[model samples]
Target chain A: MDEKSTINKDSENIERGNNIEVWEDVVNIKDLLLSILICASAAMGGYLIAPDDPQKPLLYGLVGVVIGFLVSSMIIKPKRTLRFEDEEK
Target chain B: MDLSLIMELIAISIFGAVLYTIIGIAPGTDETAVLMPVTLILVLSGLQPISVLAFFISSIVAKKLTDSIPVAIAGIPGGVLSAPMVEHAMVLKNRGLPDVSIRKMASGSVIGTLIAVPLSLFLANLLIPFGETISKYSNEIFFGGAVFLALMTKNRWLALLSIVPFALLIQGLRHLYWGTGAVPEDTTVFTSFFLGITVGPIILKLLELLNKEIRSNLPRRTTNDIVLKQQEKVKGFPNPFKILDKKETGSAAFSSVLGVFTFFMSPAGMTIFLGEVISSRIKDPIKKATRAISSMDGVTNAAYISGILIPLIAIGAPLSPTALGPGMALFNAPPVFTEDHNLHHILSMGDFIVATVIGAVIAISLTYFVTVKYSQQICTFVFKYIPHEALLGVFLALVIMLAYMDAGLINIGGVILIGLVAGVLHRWGVNYGIQFMVLYAAPWIVGNLVF
Candidate 1:
């Protein structure tokens, strides 16, 4: 059946013709620095908001979110490209 | 330990594995969501740390194989870990290798688990001191990780867009759970995480439902084609590792190194980056045979296992969704389990090592046998019996129920609204990951700025 489909079907592959590439880490490292600044600034800001106030839970959660964002950003880099550049025949 | 205690441990392992199997089969759900409720139960049950570790491993390995099934049968993905698998599965499906691909994954899982055992233990030993030293600067390290992710994305707006939404969603859901504490006293962290994962997709699906342009533009569901082109050349014993080359070997090695960085990063993201980089470098002609393709899955499993084990042994960081599931076994083991200095942590380590080896063996061994015997049957069955739209519909409903189960009906409704907003954002070529990052990141930023 696969043979039949391949023969009968258009040679066009769904995944074909697109070239996705990964960015170099040098590029990624920069993004990591920026993300950290944003998150830490955010977290430190949260810590400042309720120095000793109620809603410790919310405050702590805010801190965690900042950390999570910073960490997630650092850990996960963007895809280079979804598909590779297609070569024209 | 008493006989009953041993029996309980066995039960936990079995239960964990079963739950993992379910997670593996289901696309939207992940190990974290699966393990959340289970973790609560373990904490309450007072299970021994070693036994809890065993159960966690069993479930994780089971999911490794099961998760590949959906990606192979349907383009719809399952676990966050399985995203790469989806790409490969699509390739296999076109080539009449869907069953073969699933088997490869299973084989990969087993191989990964086995290889990870000693590798993780060795890495854990190194990470222990490193973790202790880095504890003070964990904040800086994690922050650096975030920035690295943003810049790596290439498009700054796309990166921020993806990162922000996820951060906010996590924070918002966390707040919603906390808010409910005054009312029902039932809201918990497990529910909050579950709500986040479940609601995101459900909201996305709802948007797919609501938007007229999208609804109209949705492609007509394609019928499954089960017949295959017979190829004798494709048959015979193929070395599973035969696909690796110099470039992919490099990525795999990098991924393995990054695996140890869980103290400040997500291994899943690292795997994607490594795979992407390798994919980017491979000039088209060499892409398929690129060692990175094979290594992507291998390194991911390696990284994932290492990520979990390092944290467990080092600073007791339950980082991976799987590790976090059995979190109590590491973080809060009772005095009886560890009367001495952090002996319970060692117990978690031992279990991780053991489970990794066992899971890897099981995944590889079973995948091979299953693929050999039933690949054709399974593919044919999927094509003949399963309706693509029905499968999608089921997934949609599952996502909603999963969210509802986490934070109550109100939270589910909120996620639906969130998903619609996300859908609109997605239309603008913004990324899903960056959005998720934002949702996860926002609360802290907001609090810090306000305070």
Candidate 2:
């Protein structure tokens, strides 16, 4: 089944080009760079925009992390496929 | 404690348990890298000390319980702690009993949590009288720990030789930060450098990816296909005692007790050692593998809990590898939790017990059930929706922001430089344990080097 998927799916991947694997999962390089930029800018933005307080900038930056994670999650479709088999008994 | 505070602790524990349960199943999330950032954020956000303690304990328990299930489902380990059990888990997976691996490992985790919490707290109480002595000599102790851990590594000579030089690099960076007035002289610029070590390998990897020649030669994959073995739905709340056989339960409990005692040593190392010793007498392949995974899971969980608890209760500093890595924020998030005034100084003995009990019980019950009953479903959701790039991006962004917060724009370059050097040393087999101890003892080692 795995071989069949790879052979049959190579045509689509050649065009879609989401073929790179990183940290035990598949990711396109362009998307990864875009996500990093978006997340980092947002985090820095949140930190710079915060009221001058010891904890508030850090809090806002953390909130920005969540927002960036959400945006990236929505825009990027995970490049993984799942199949389930009956337990071998 | 106020009723509201107690209620808040419970709520935070639930949130931590639920969150870590999902994070645990997501393969390849390193324990330190993922855990430290979140806990640091919580500490810096000004949560009450006890609430942060409860959340952290709950997260570790939940993380330990669910991390190994990925090994059963796929050949992949969920985190560094689970990496040792992969070989044993593969034995079961090959024999068509993958779900059995999940049940035993998770049950072992529950048992470990039960044994370690009380044992660790009790041990901490016995050591309280000596806490001051230990605190006074923390620098010497940390330097000693770095040497001890370095000698224990596979590349001992390389590890040993790297320690002093690494200490110099760390101290040199801080001195530069201070001399340039990038940060106030009193501030230590610790959190970002700590984070740099955790993010080091990624920085190296990302740079390599940018090289056209290296990129061309790198392994390419169209997709990451995950195959799952369907598990039977567990009826009612699963009982750990019933899930593990008598012998498995006995070995897991015994190893866990030892794990608590050896909290200062590497948990992964102890897990591999104790698992083999305990399971060596068993002859049957299936039985031996099962025993190994169960016992290994127990040791990993117990060691982690003890590593966090003993230091938090007995000493305010991070004296254990587990404490120094994932639990670093608890001891020294700076401004929020300084070595002199963290959880150890804030919470009473009774408060520690209450927070721990709530955290451990909630995590065991919730994560054990989810891991045993619906591992396949959880794995599916994470694989389908959670992109690895986003996780990496968030971690990278968090490190950058924290670096900026530490000193200013100039310190970002300092962190990247630290990350590059750390990455090279790490690739040379200098483990994180030695590196973290060096980080703790850097100023001392560098200061004492003066003629």
CA error at residue B382 for candidate 2, angstroms: 1.4
Which ranges of candidate 2 are over 4 A from the true structure? Answer: A1-12, A15-18, A87-89, B1-9, B19-52, B66-105, B242-251, B266-296, B321-346
Q: Show where candidate 1 strays beyond 4 Å.
A: A1-89, B1-23, B39-43, B130-143, B161-202, B221-239, B242-254, B260-264, B284-293, B319-352, B355-364, B367-373, B421-443
lDDT by residue (B1-451, candidate 1, tens digit) is: 3677556665666676665664466444555545544554564466655665666566666666566676665645656566544565666555555555555555455455556657777877877777666555544444455557666665656655455455555556567767766225543334334334433544464444446676555443212234343323335644444434455445555554555444235445565566676556555533442334345555556655665666677656443433434233445434433323333345655555554455444444444344434545554554443333333333333434445444556755655656666565544544343343343335555455454
Worst 10 residues of 1 chain B by lDDT: B220-229
C-alpha RMSD by candidate, in order: 13.5, 4.2
User: Which candidate should be chosen as best, given TM-score against the real structure?
Assistant: 2
Native RMSD of candidate 2 (Å): 4.2
The Cα local distance difference test for each model comes to 0.49, 0.83
Query: How big is the positional error of residue B164 in model 1, measured in Å on the Cα after superposition?
Result: 4.8
